[model samples]
Target chain A: MRNLPSSEAGAGPETVDATRRTLLQTGLFGSLLLGAAGATATLSGCTGRTEATAAGYKFLRDADLPFLRALLPGVLGSLLPAAGMERDRLLDDLLHRIDLSGYRLGLPSQKALAQLFDLLNMRLTRRLMAGIGPWEESTPAQVQAFLERWRGSSFAVLNTGYRALIKLVAGSFYGTPAGWAAANYPGPPPGPYQVFNS
Target chain B: MAIDDIYTKGIADGWKVVDASTLKQDQTYEADVAIIGSGAGGGTAAEILSAAGLKVLILEEGPLQTAANFKDMNDARAYGELYQEGAGRATSDGAVAILQGRSVGGTTTVNWTSSFRTPPQTLQYWADTFALKGGGEADMAPWFAQMEERLGISPWAVPPNANNDALKRGADKLGWAAHVIPRNVRGCWNLGYCGLGCPTNAKQSMLVTTIPSALKNGAQLVHHVSVRKLQFSGGKVSGLSAEALGPDGVKRSGVNITVKARHYVLAGGAINNPALLLRSNAPDPHQRIGKRTCIHPVNLSLAMMPEKVEGYYGAPQSVYSDEYQWKHGATGPAGYKIEVAPMQPLLGSVIFGRYGEELKTGMAQLPNMQSMLALLRDGFDEQSPGGSVEIDDSGAPVLHYDFSDYMWDGFRRAYLSMAELQFAAGAKQVMPLHLDSRPYESWEQTRTAIGGLQYRKQRVPVFTAHLMGGCAMGEDEKLTVVDSDARFRHADNLSIIDGSIFPTSIGANPQLSIYGFACKNATKLAGVLKA
Candidate 1:
């Protein structure tokens, strides 16, 4: 763990490129992929290729789905439906919402998010950073542990990644009426105003 | 009873409203004055200039969403359609979330309707520090009153909902200076969905009032056109090149547009106005265009009230306290105003920032959640130099704001105050919106914990809905981008009539400040153009 104020020390002194490079070199990606000193080659290969998923998502490459799915139950907890078809449907809907939101982000933010996802999706980084091999085989406890690890990580990048994931999941889920209903919200109050759309 | 979507009637009555997204070929507009951005500033300017018998063109980047689109009162839909970046805008490093509006009416269409004049202390600070003139309390009172009367601005008469009432109750108990917030509305339904577009068309936003009036007075409005850059020569704006955005309002269509005007008004607000200037390579001999951008950086505290606060109903903000606002003066360490936020599920969950079972459990108490936010008044002290607006590789505006230790100290103090107030208002437990914070049952416990907590950026989530001060106005060209008359210092015939003209952060909600300044500056510009 490192020690420095995040806003001043972290935001300054390091460019986005520098941060990504440093994150890859010293951390989880380092031990996994860079043992052969192939970091630069691997890093260049990671960009621009996964901009879209084969499933026709504008963002959210196919590899990101399993990781997000594994984290959903832990992120939503009791909010997620019991392990059944209903839960699967809700998860799919939430992923769709998350995908739409991600696609709508500005170019810089989308670029940053893509890099974060790249780090998480790669086999080497996933094993080291998440402490798991494949998200499909990851248990809820493993997901929770990974989340806690990142949330408590000294690196601001990991914390930011954690925040982005949690916010996307929570905000997208809670934005729905079903989420509101489950949360005991009575929904928006009725008003006298109505609109007749032409 | 159905509320008439005014755009339909206005268009039927011969208003020249164009959806640029529908344009197939290149277009050119010739106007006496062209306003880029149709929010509080642009909308206000359009009405005044159009009324003065000048041909005015208003270009909006977002779609022309009306009451018809807002009737659903859905947060997700509203954020997607009406807000900037689908309400996903943040500081460059993702440390602070920015809630800015992008639609035709701009933020005024989606704001919580708290109309506050620029606080006297803030005005004095601007004058004393930035050498700003013609913007003192006395000089601005008439303009403020005129805009107030024009927009039906008055103290909200409705009873405070439980969420706002908690702040009032707490302030009253603590002997703090709290008051009912003024709102620019007519026959408001108190629906608490003002953050969505107002379905009742009663909020007196630019869409409902000034833009429609401008249209009535023969002004033309084109929506979904993004201004690319101003073509400038010899310290004067020549024309602007723009491209029509698609219906999704993200990608560009092939249809290009050019606007030629005798005068150009930049009212794109804070980060945007500065970014446009920077992108256009507008003359910046002093390099002051994008400097000093301030967002009233916000930190919030959540309280689980004993009573059902049900923050998602009634008027979103009807009460506020200014006890700490000017206590230490403007240039001191940082001071903040305390207000409450409506704890709708999505926003609440985002703020709470807990996960797993804790998230579900906390969310289940939605009806009882009362959120208090402190607008940490930045950009006054040397330490609080505020952010700068920089355009990314794609020419999109990105704000780089740093959280100084000075501001973090203010945040720590504000958290303590909010927790104390929540406890005074009989909250069961209060949690400062920090990743390390948990629910504290007592004010003393919260004070101790918050004091000891590490005040880091990612650890404590900060947010800003109020974007202010990028192209600041002052007498010194060395220090400011615009003059007191809102005229660009470097570019002749280019005026900025928006929140971007403030030399520092207004220690209050900035809608009224923008309205009053736009009214004053646009009137002067109209007079000059008429002559």
Candidate 2:
């Protein structure tokens, strides 16, 4: 159990790598929301994969991948496992679980989430809805900055999107068993924990 | 050793448990009373109606979850199997998260078992304003006592958990009126695993009590069946259509079947009941089908304590303070009840409201965290006329609830009250559950931070477990879907015997309220049929 208060600056801080350097590049140049100018032009930068994988998870369109791949390490930067195939597996499971929940909120919410997914998944729409993207080209701090902008925005729509997206990402990440160490939540009850894990 | 599931024994002993997901062909069934949901209200009603020698059939939209399927308390499994929309159901814009259950026992299987009776003021208001003749505090006392006895409900005998102790200490220091919350459990192990469905069969949820009794008395329960519409003939509900779901419980696999009964009970809680009525195009001459739906929208104040709270252990909840509930009066500023939510990881993580290192830091303090949730009472005044439930283009329910300024004023006051209470309790830092607010190390800092925080729907965190009122029971056909007798005013033989029938929010946790209401109404229904 951790004894210190949050004023103690950091907990489980990590050093960034070269692959992460690829993430810190793009900025919407202080534009929190892309104005009418974004809507007028046809976006051509939606150049990510947009299909289902062989794993056969129900949701997560191909265009959705780059956005999530960019967002997770930022939203769950320190809590998520280090950058590798193991981390990739963890992210995969997180997205899959969130997708299952999407199926449960019925068709309307499913559509709304899918629309949000579509908007964020595409480079042009991501840039338009939120001012910075091609998220792979931005650092975790920049991504965090964009999220905080949405969280502190005067616009209700931006706040709503920020809340929806982060909750899905953060919830799915922290809820999983692999993410338990950071939260210090001893896994399940003792009896059930031993039964399931041991 | 794997626990020998109670359902296995019941099934072996010839309980009429039908897995609708495995149904092969279209089959019509007949019963004296057909209940649409199988949660707290429906389960209670089923036992009573069946015991009264009325043939009963229950259709549950969610799968039948038992000890066999509890899945080692994994939230992922529980939500998928036992919750509405996989525990992902939210309002239209997704501002408020709702946590209603969807399994055979409905929310009773998943609720934190704090049982509270309908407050005297609320019952009196119903009687005075809503044409409820015999539903005043005095008139309904016997029914309340009966359900309380039946459910083994009593004030928790054990000490409050550390998380709850903080609330008690704060209330005591401030000389506020706090009380031990009564719970519906027998031989409880004091485990905080109630939301995942009780593993030890100690919690007397309808899943363990009434549903089993109903089944024993020849009631047939079909799980994974979706009841679509109530078909009417001769001004009464004659039949209803249902589709059997597939293995996944979402896709329709079996042929459609119609159920006919002398009486039809709609116990699909608030959202689904209103959605069903709207879809069937039921006559709402006054257009009050889904208006005035109330949710006890809750806000949390997370207090990082100096000692280890480990809120995830012990009883989920056992203490509460109603000091502010009626301080401003029922009709004055919206009153709120103070309580704590168990910091189970999934729900706790989302409630923390941060990302990256910030969340990581907060997560590390989980053992030392004590949080208080102020369930801001809605629907008493015009300021909180309450949210409405409307259907989407696809006939699925879309709840539209926007927090008004009056409600925000109550929330602001609630944040201040909770922060003061937390500071008074011990050495700690407190933070309102807002995206913008940081952990304030002192009472003065908390007060200042709460004052400046933006009070908007998406900006602040909000949640509700107590979903109440939609097909409100009233005498005036223009104002309510059902009358005080719980019978649909426009349609004979149709009765809403659940939380939806509440004319207003029942000022406390609603399980006991629903249980008592069902007992009274179903008993009356039984008497009417016998006559």
Candidate 3:
């Protein structure tokens, strides 16, 4: 059973590397086949904005990256590195993977995800739907409060939005090889993976 | 040693296999039978009909991924390429998650291998209530035996893995009706990677078994082709049109292909089959096309076991308990069958349904996390009439299923039963997969907590891998879409030969039920066509 929604959101590191990595590594989608993170990818590139024009990834807009940026760190604490280049690269990696997953979503689910993220992308809409966010300004505690409120609300739409965000972020964050060590899945099974992982 | 990929050699040996994505121009083909899927029912029927000297052609929307491609054993690759919508398909409202496969072998390529014959009670109910001719326990016995022997179906010979052992131990301790699940596999490594496609060709999935045999027997298999609609000429399907999908399996390449066959078989499983018919605007005088689509609507309970369950390391499912299934009798309020799920990280995390530190705490316990799901038997009564299937703007399938009070009662009971059994099997804590649920330390605590939990949509993470009905069989055309022989009542040349033909839920994993019934019906269809 899923854990009961706990109201306490005060347990994670607050150090956020607000630097948005410019290199939107396309390896997130490719890494899915290997079932591992692009451990080979590094945070070497300097700041320059690049659009995600890859095919099959059409959901997340550039403006939506900030919303995910603020929420992902709060939702995924130490699963991502606390602070540094490793943290920046992993966050960028997580966002790319999340974007890839968003585009692959079915139409109905895509609409739901788009609607939820759209609310998060706009300050006014975020205030109305999520009840306070200019994501960059909102503290992790505030974001946590917003998620908790929606998750616990009786309205089905809020619950739906919360589940969509949580599933996308958590699933993508943990799916990477960086997160596998924390989860204790000792890589792929030694038997057949030897042929490929080698 | 790497296992041999069967299709490559079979194709080299004069077997016809086409990747529609590679088609540079429009093409047309004719066959004695054009089957619109390559799953359990379609594969089984293909083998039988082709063996009977019928030229069979199988049209599949997904790509043909085999053991060679399955060597990675990656969930993302499997879900992205083999599953319906990157493994994120859900109910139209996004309340319930659906795990349906969309590869060459459809769900057979991705399902946990648990083979059971259609229950005697379910068969009897069909005969009594729906006036379904044949398919009784006695009638289907030989067909079941035939398929079982053909697919190497038998009780798992090895000892149950830790995950299954817990289920067995609990059911035994509780004196419940639990037993070893029979599996369709040969040379199984006990490697627990069946859901990611068997890299060793151990699982007797249709991809490795029936489909190959059918191909060898002169059947044509085409992958990456999504059939658009059946071209109706008054009462019969004169033609079928389809669009070719690209390598990604989602976008079409705009290469339209048409098929003409003496007989058309719709084996696209429950949801796809109904949506295909509905999209074509097929005649449904009684509106029985997409009605009563049964999904053994599942609700799960999680356990923190004393020992490392390693739930993902062996046969995903080898033990199941039917204690609560027949407790209220077949016709009473809905009953459920309990089974364990493989602890894939992403699947577990989603069901773990936590975030940040809360999610991490659960992730840290993955080795000890065990999940038990209840397959609720639906469609037997008015309160639990089951869901329906509709198409989206792009004609893609969308399912709409609402939980009933009867189903909720079944969910409450199933959760309590699972928690009790998990505790009996040495779980430290048991929790129903509900939004409001907390880890209860004891069976008594779980009983108290579960009784108070709401069985609403997102509140409980409901899912279904088993889909049935939607084009149910009956002797009366007014109450059913297909006749007892699974032939469409309105279209003389068309047949619905998959799980869609079942009038109600089978109360078990549906692979063998589909295989046996398709084997029997296709043989009959073969004989009739041969005459």
| Model 3 per-residue lDDT tens digits across residues A35-139 | 111121223221212333234334465667778889887787667777899999888887888876765665445544544554465444466667885888877
What TM-scores do the predictions have?
0.94, 0.92, 0.91
How does chain A of every candidate compare to the true chain A by TM-score?
A: 0.72, 0.68, 0.67
Q: What DockQ results do all the predictions give, each relative to the true complex? A: 0.33, 0.26, 0.18
1 or 2, greater by lDDT: 1
Over A13-73, each residue of candidate 1 has an lDDT whose tens digit, in order, gives 2233443554453342224333322353365464323333538565676778888888788
Model 2 TM-score on a 0 to 1 scale: 0.92
> What digit string (tens of lDDT, one per residue) describes model 1 on residues B1-531?
456889998899999999999999999999999999999999999999999999999999889998888887888898877888788888877889889999989999999999999988898998998898899999999999999999999999999999999999888898988999999999987888999899888899999999999999999999999888998898799999988888888767778899999999998889789888888999988888889989998999989998899999989999999889888888787999999998778888888888998888888998999999999999999999989998764566778889888999999999988998999999999999887888999988998999899888788899999999889898988999888899987778899999999888898999999999999999999999999
Provide the clashing-pair count of each candidate structure: 0, 9, 2
Question: Model 1, which residues run further than 4 Å from truth?
Answer: A1-51, A191-198
Give the best candidate by TM-score.
Answer: 1
> Which candidate order results from sorting by DockQ in descending order?
1, 2, 3
* lDDT score, candidate 1: 0.84
Candidate 3 chain B lDDT trough over 10 residues, lowest sum: B390-399
